[model samples]
Target: MDHVILFEGIPMSKSMRGMCKEEDYAFLGEKGKHHKETDTLGEDWKEEKMERERRRRERAQQEQERIRELEESRKEKEQQWRHHVSELASTQEQRLRDRLARIHHFRDFQRKVLVEEMSLQTDSESSQALDQLLTRI
Candidate 1:
């Protein structure tokens, strides 16, 4: 009697040629064990590949989130710095305006007192000096 092999639900015989490659045959002590092991190994390999891919995608997402947080932080710092600089500039401007106003008031008060204390004809040069100083200021 001739022995026949069933491979994946298909009958195969020794006389068959070009139907399957020689590498597809396994000659171990246990029949069909090599094919079953090959099938299980393929399943395991697919599972491992999918798991690694999942991990890689998760890492990429986490990195993107971290980058977004850093960008927001950097923008916040820049905004704070701009606000601080503007406040300082406003304070300095107000102080300068106050100083200018005080100087103008003092000059006017001095002019009035000097005019009342001296004769205009003899104190013309003094009056001119006061005018020049006020203009220069």
Candidate 2:
């Protein structure tokens, strides 16, 4: 007696060239038994997959746009801060130069006063010497 296998109501003999059609065969086990097909996903599985992929892409795009905006804002803020710091440095340098100029002016005034005092003392000593010489004569 010849043994026969039936899959999806189709009879398959041992010596048959093509035992089962590709679409009708679900999964072939080690024992050569074909597993029955089941509904792993509902009828709306394709639509659900499409919707999920669309939402994911949208979220990724939004995140990228937000990062770009943040970078631009950060660059602008950094430029403004640099400008502010430069202005402060320039103002401080100008103030320092003005202070140094004032110190120089005060030093020049003190030197002029010392020279005048020395000249007056020398003139008075010479006049006293001339008077003593005249009295001796």
Candidate 3:
């Protein structure tokens, strides 16, 4: 008598070549041990594949998040650097203006002193030198 094999509630036999491959026949062994072991191995392989895919997706997401954070930090630093440079330039300009104002005041004071001294002295040589120096300044 010929034994009938069942796969997914359907009868399978060696003559049914279209229904299963030759390797499917290897699942038949003493006490159905071969089929059970094959089923267990298949389930384990699928589970392992799914786990690996999950871990890969998680790692990719983490990398993207890290890159986004780095970009934000870079922009923030750039903005801060620009602000610092602007402040430094403003302060330097103010100091330059102050120095120019003081120089102008000193020049005016020297001119007043020269005028008063020339009125009291008839020394023409020193008067000419002082006038030349004031003109140079």
For candidate 1, what is the TM-score? Answer: 0.62
Better of 1 and 3 by lDDT: 3
CA shift of 77, model 2, Å: 2.4
lDDT of 3: 0.78
Off by over 4 Å in 3: 1-32, 120-132
Q: What does candidate 3 score on TM?
A: 0.65
Q: Which candidate number has the best lDDT?
A: 3
lDDT score, candidate 1, position 105: 95
Reference-based lDDT, residue 64, model 2 = 100
Q: Across residues 26-88, which tens digit of lDDT does each residue of candidate 1 receive?
A: 342345557788888999999999999999999999999999999999999999999999999
Model 2: per-residue Cα lDDT over 52-104, one tens digit each: 99999999999999999999999999999999999999999999999999988
Question: Candidate 1: lDDT of 32?
Answer: 58
Candidates in order, TM-scores: namely 0.62, 0.53, 0.65
| lDDT of residue 35 for candidate 2 | 19
| Residue range 11-76, candidate 3, lDDT tens digits | 556578676763565444343656788788999999999999999999999999999999999999
Report lDDT (Cα) of residue 4, candidate 3.
Answer: 34
* Ranked by lDDT, top first: 3, 1, 2
